[model samples]
Target: MEGKDTDQIPLLIPYKLGQIRLSHRIVLAPLTRFRSYNSIPQSHAILYYSQRTTKGGFLIAEAACISRAAQGFKNTPGIWSKEHIDAWKPIVDAVHAKGGIFFCQLWHPGRVSDQSFEPNVGQAPVSSSDKQCSPLVDGGVEFKFLTPRKLNSDEIRPIVDDYRMAARNAIEAGFDGVEIHGAHGYLIDQFLKDQVNDRTDDYGGSLENRCRFALEVVETIANEIGPDKVGIRLSPFSNYMDAGDSNPEALGIYLAKSLNKYGILYCHVVEPRMEVMEERTECVVSLGPMRRAFNGTFIAAGGYEREDGNNAITEGRADLVAYGRLFLANPDLPRRFELDAELNKHNRDTFYSPDPVVGYTDYPFLETII
Candidate 1:
């Protein structure tokens, strides 16, 4: 995929995070395509992710639900079924064949969900408390309120077990590791945010208590499949889904410290966003505090381009960088960086639709004439 101008581009470098040695610092972040609307991913879904694999790069698979009740957006994939695991096997195997590492990002969307997308027999999304999410109905429908069921002390144990089962499924599917989706104002982030979590139990009041569920899930996943094969993603202070923790600094520090104790692979954080007209402006937050808290590797995502990714590594703020939409538009993203090639613009219309081969995996890699 290298271009004629590749010689002018800075030399791409290799880096190491714990036991995982990356040939390049670039990583493909989890971007939700929603093409796999059904609970099970099809063979085409396998081809989509497999096509993006490059030598020693990392692929964090799009958010796969931990359970049926956790399904949120239409067409999103899940790991709750045997068919799901079977469907993903070829994708992970293909990445391995290319000498790349793949991680299935496990998630539960929680109250950020609609009843229309609920699983066949599951209840409305469950969260740390019974709270209604800011309704932004996906398909141009009139917005409706979602009163999610709250998990009690007894009920919490099973959901935690679901995470463990999902982790086991990831390994069975041939993934190198598993990434817990604790970011983007989803289930785990809902638990961390005081505005969403209002219960009086240990999982509600203080910052430590608010992070209890996340800690439990991380610890459980690490225990299930060695800490080296587990990682967690978090959006500390962003309101991507109307989520904000009472004390972001404290929450970040505490969670980072707890994760370090597990000796997991890394912690991926989404940088803060500022609204600018119709679009949002992304800025890098100081990673100094979090770097101190987590002794393991750290990755930064959200609006990071090649130069920014390089800068983040140069500044010692991040060990690696994750690209979401950029990777969507440019499948050979690392090569694009290596050659300083102009990227293909993403078609926003096809981002979430169910049509196959449109936005799913149509991006062609750049080829050069020797």
Candidate 2:
């Protein structure tokens, strides 16, 4: 009897989200770049994306604040303005020209902001309560701990409407879909996590109440841009942006069941872990619970490698894999993976610098022309 061909490699297959069939499972994760031109995605952004396009792949654009108050960072993009929507059209067009699908991640920082980023002049950041988000204050010149003002019933309605408007704006900007930035302890996550939400109103005090805000945003966005074009990101136990849930498991169950009502395309779940291990195992490791909760196509992200990514699909834990830092270092990451070429290491120093030419477009790729 011939020796068993143990080397039969499992074919790395493509995944689908509703009608959108991806040629590969590699997804470009939503990464924040403070390189927006005048708080709007610029021509450089179009060039930046054009360089990173992969055949049959999808790119989740960096978080764009849904409203003025949603902006906490110095130079992040926003979808609330006409200029922002107009500016993003070319970028979306460029991505489509390369046969790639793009989705803009809509976000609002809420309490995770400073006075400089406030909407109303000199107003404090808003949240579910008066709790301070940051645990540290470097200094007045650098950074300081900020206590957020509570959002009253009157203000909550318009804030929820902002998401609906942002969704409409995303469609105007020529995006394939919109992903709600409900992760990383931002506004929606802040409302979801009990630690930050101390409200006695209908929006808080209980798990269901705490989730009310996020659910509203989801429903509103779905209604504005059709359910098939809407998706969300959720990190049940992420400590990065000070988001914490009393019971992550219960939160996942509740969120999953609630989100399913919208008929959205996918629920992107970030796998929480410590080590910088391979992507496949690390991605799915935290998803066993989410997979049980969410019945739709699931996109798993955070520190994934090719092998670990393929395992996620083969194991049925994830429908797609979102790659972050890897895409930054290798513009042709999907091609590099197909060829099994060595990847370029990313420079940590220039990760967030103002200099446009350095980390933004300096990475090289295989010489296909040669």
Candidate 3:
């Protein structure tokens, strides 16, 4: 933003991502707005995603639970049924209308969930192990976590199929692709991170074993759809939701190499724990090795700004950089970055509000603000 010509900006450089030739390198990181009520995407999302669409830009939708049992928090979208697929069709079309490439992020909360968010008659939340998450403390009031039921050897294939089915549902709903939510201590991460995965079965113990479940999901989804239509988000360096690994760098590189076997679209890796999901400082580990190991396009996310993003691309650290909060507040994020325009400060309080227009689509575009 400071030193060079706007035309020379690395973020503005066009790059081919698998099948699509993108107009820019900035991606809209999947932000879970919690605005989809009753587990169904609402009409309001049309304006929300459409406002952010730029010709040939990429946007990953918020985490859509693979099944009813996968719903961790309230009001998140689901893709496990035909009704859900129909609901997403319009929203997907809205982005496509503007020539934007949209990818649905499929996820399962696993142990991060509680029975309270379940559909009729609550069943126990399942994970790789029976260990429960520690209660979250907020203003001295605690929300305790129930002991999650451990998945038996026989039950793993069904959940793997859930991911495969969700990916197919997303494509049926008119999405360009599906990104597996393998990051953020979700179902896949619960198995990848050794801290939570205490299984003595084939899914635990050795690093390769811990990664088996994730690979299965990737392979199933790739086969169900196609490898070019698949991507997986991973954060081996993150300790969020109590899913930290002992050797994160190794974990990161290993997953990157493993993913090459399927030749998925891209690897979206978050910054280390301290920089993840927050405004940041530098992290101890660098993503260079992971980026190098990943044969497909590599997207680096978490706490990146215009200058930082440009630097990452220029330095060949990543093929693309994702912006979460920035994109949330500034729908015309790529244009704003191109012009070095001032960004509207985001209201953190209303970020997760259920109101459709409050902090959701009310953020003005660059033209209106000027």
Candidate 4:
């Protein structure tokens, strides 16, 4: 196949977000590979990440649970212990050795967790309210979610502290920075959305009150690690894992404006495709408004092809574009995009398997395939 002219692709251009400079606008979105065994990153992770690293490329690690109670999936890594920190050090080093920038995504699953996956099996998951939801787990089994116990007013601070310490852990583990996983129906998103957060305390009732928990977590983590080194991911229109908002556009704009106060490194937003699961009058809620509201760098993710991502960046819809499946199948994704090369098809079946290699690091580079 003939290569596309490099001048036509805006994705190959370098960009800077605060102190972090990236060689290209293509970012490797955080993907849950589930290769970590016993909640610790293993040797396979180093190869899995380094293979995708391009010089000065920006890669966000898959969400690392902030605490044991925050864990929701099997084999997902954690950053809450000394061993977890020690384990991540080499993985971070490998990316750095390739001249890449890495960010650890700190996460908490909240009420979206199953009893079988909890530290205390049979323990009910905790959330802002007692609403229960049954979500599909691995192997297509529908796991019945328990009615979560409402977090006591005093209990909220400890969760914030958990995020603060996790930020510290990421820095110690040699990560360039940290991205707070406030999106995708996780703990922070659970609190931000009104459909799930039914409470009369300071953490609920008004929009400002509802945003309190998310703000606190961001503030605490930013203080722990410099605000310039911190970023956040938000899915205002997402109903996945049962997180939906009455007014996503308004919520997104409010968050964008609020986040501007801290001068964070970037704010990552999921594109409209992921929000389609929930019925909406508008097929695609534009990120343009949110982009204009925020002062810092903005990243757009979900359902973006090379041309779409380049258009989004060139049109000023986002400062960067994150790709998930494309990067997963093409270890040399940046070069492939630059050349308009054929992308390897990703096998969905092997996405979360515990195999050390196979689909994980076995994807051949362009040169190897040639």
Candidate 5:
């Protein structure tokens, strides 16, 4: 891929995301691979991330829990302690050695978690509301969410501070930046989605109120690390874990406009027609409006293939396209897209499998393909 012509593919073209110049617009989406053991990033991740690294390419690491209270799933990495921060250093250095720009995706699962994953044992996870998220069953996997205790008004500041600390930890771990996980019915989305947030506080009820918690996190993170090193992933169009909005378009537009106040490095949005269920019936199919409203680098994700991804960048639907499953199976995803080569199929069974190398680092590169 070093010397081969890019063939004028829109996704292969160079673009600048803040001061960080990317050689291409194909992003490695933040996916929960469930390989990190005991809430700390394992050594296997070094090769896993390094396999996908390319010169000047951007890769967002798997979502790392911002604090003990924020954990919602098993085996997911964390950024809350000295051990967690130290564990991520070598992995970050591996990606940097390959000249890839890595961003640690900091998240708080909030109510999306269960009792077993909690640090305080049976203590309920915190969220904007006390409503319990429905259990998730996909691809022969089942996850039952515990009823979350609603955060008291005064309790909100501490969680925000956790996010700030996580961002600082990400930078100290040698990551180029951090992407806040505000998408997919996690802690932040719990506030944004009216379907689950049944509150009448300063953080719920109105659009601004619902979004207040999110913007505060943005402001605090931006102030802690600097706006240029910050980005956020949002999913206003889809509902997972029963966190649906009454009006997604308005919610998306509101958040997009509000995010401009902080001037974050980029806004990565999950594309429509996602794993949306009852919300899918709403037929929300475009990210154009949100992309237009946000006055920064825009990254569109979810179910994009080579042609459509190229079209998105060229037609200005987004400045970049993030690939999840495709990239997970094809470590040389950028090279494959460049050559229009056959991609290896992804095995769903191993997506969250406990095996370290079976599906984690076993994906083949073009050179090794017979």
Candidate 6:
């Protein structure tokens, strides 16, 4: 889709975002490609990320599991160990060398995890409640999730501490900042959604209580690495991993209002149209109200075409637009958007393949084809 001709296209404009100044409003969204093996980032990751880096561009790295217990997917990277930190250092440095700002996304899968992928084999996943959902299978049919063990009150603090330590590890690995992956039915999302969080303790039940786990993790990460360097990703209406909120609109506004006090760098929200891990619902809540609630920079993602992204930024709905699949297929996506060039379609088959470079760093630049 072509962007409308205008004197100023908001997507191409430079903006100052927190401590980092962005050259354009296009952000590379965090995507799980399942390329890392044994929870360690590989050499191809450096090439993949650097290929997408543009001067002053913002790139949020794929969600890195905060601890061994937090892992859910196969071959996904983590930020828990010193070895992991060392592995990520070169990737971060490569992006920085190209003048791109990189943020490591801190993640925990909670009840969404599979026993085979868990650090302790044969152990069930942990979550706010003892509910079960389907575990992700590569090129296979979905399977039922093992009933997760409910996190005890004493165990909650340690999980929060894991996020704090992960934030420190991200900084030590040369990341410009850390983004708390509180969205899309992950560990944090499990706590935020009432459908999943059935606990009567202080960490569940009421909206404030349900949101406590998310808040604590964010606050701890923000405190560990200055709030100016912290950002969060949220998906209120997302039904992913069986995480559907009773009142998505109210939940979104409340979370935004609460996050306002933290002075975080940005709030990255998934647009209502895209379905992450579940079937699309008929009910769609507009992100307009939530955008207004948060005073910081707002990033909108999911199913955005060139024109749609430009319009969202031009209409004042979002300060920036994040592209996932489009960026994956087009390494120089920002330049393509600038010149209104044709976008290479992403190959769905190789998206999560374990291949080192088939879909990782093989996408050609516009100049190469020209």
Q: Highest TM-score: which candidate?
A: 5
**Where in model 3 is the C-alpha error above 4 Å?**
1-6, 114-116, 120-122, 137-144, 273-281
Residue-level lDDT tens digits of model 4 in 1-370 = 1355655678877888787888888999999888899899998899999999988899999999999888877789999999999999999999999999999999998888765566657677789888876565542334556668789889999999999999999999999999999897778888999888998999997888889999898888888889988999998977777888899888899999999777789999997675222223344568889999999999999778888889997898999999888899999999888877888988767777889898899988999887
| Model 6 quality (TM-score) | 0.95
Candidate 1, run of 10 with poorest lDDT: 2-11
lDDT per prediction?
0.79, 0.80, 0.89, 0.86, 0.89, 0.88
Residues 1-370 of candidate 6 have per-residue lDDT tens digits of 2345534767988889976788899999999888889999998999999999988999999999999888787899999999999999999999999999999999998888765555668788899989887666543334346678899999999999999999999999999999999988888899999889899999988889998988888888888889999999999988877898898888899999999888888999988787443333444568999999999999998788899999998899899999998999999998899888899988777888899988778988999999
Give the local distance difference test score of model 1. Answer: 0.79
Question: Per-residue CA lDDT of candidate 5, range 1-370, in tens?
Answer: 5757886888999888889888999999998988888898999999999999998999999999998877788899999898998999999999999989999999998888854465668688888888988877654577888888999999999999999999999999998999999999999999998997878989989999999999999999999999999999999977787888999899999999999999999999987676432132335358899999999999998788899899988899999899988899999999899988999988887888778899889988988985
Can you write out model 1's per-residue Cα lDDT over 92-207, one digit (the tens) per residue?
Answer: 88778888889999988877886566564446667877877776644234334477888877888798999999999989988889999998778899889887888798888988
Backbone clash pairs for candidate 6 read none
lDDT of 2 at 34: 77
lDDT of 2 by residue, 160-261 (tens): 999999989999999999999998778988889888888888988888899999999899888888998988999886765567877887887789888888
- Write model 3 residue lDDT over 321-351, tens digit each, in one string: 9998899999999989998899998877777
Which stretches of candidate 2 lie above 4 Å from their native place? 1-12, 114-120, 135-145, 274-285, 368-370
Error of 4 at 74 (Å): 1.6
Please, what's the RMSD in Å of model 1? 2.8
Residue-level lDDT for 212 in candidate 3: 97
Against the hidden reference, what TM-scores do the models get?
Answer: 0.92, 0.90, 0.95, 0.95, 0.96, 0.95
TM-score result, candidate 4: 0.95
Clashes of each: 2, 3, 0, 0, 0, 0
Clashes of 6: 0
| True lDDT of residue 316, candidate 2 | 83
Prediction RMSDs, each to the true structure:
2.8, 4.7, 2.6, 2.6, 1.9, 2.6
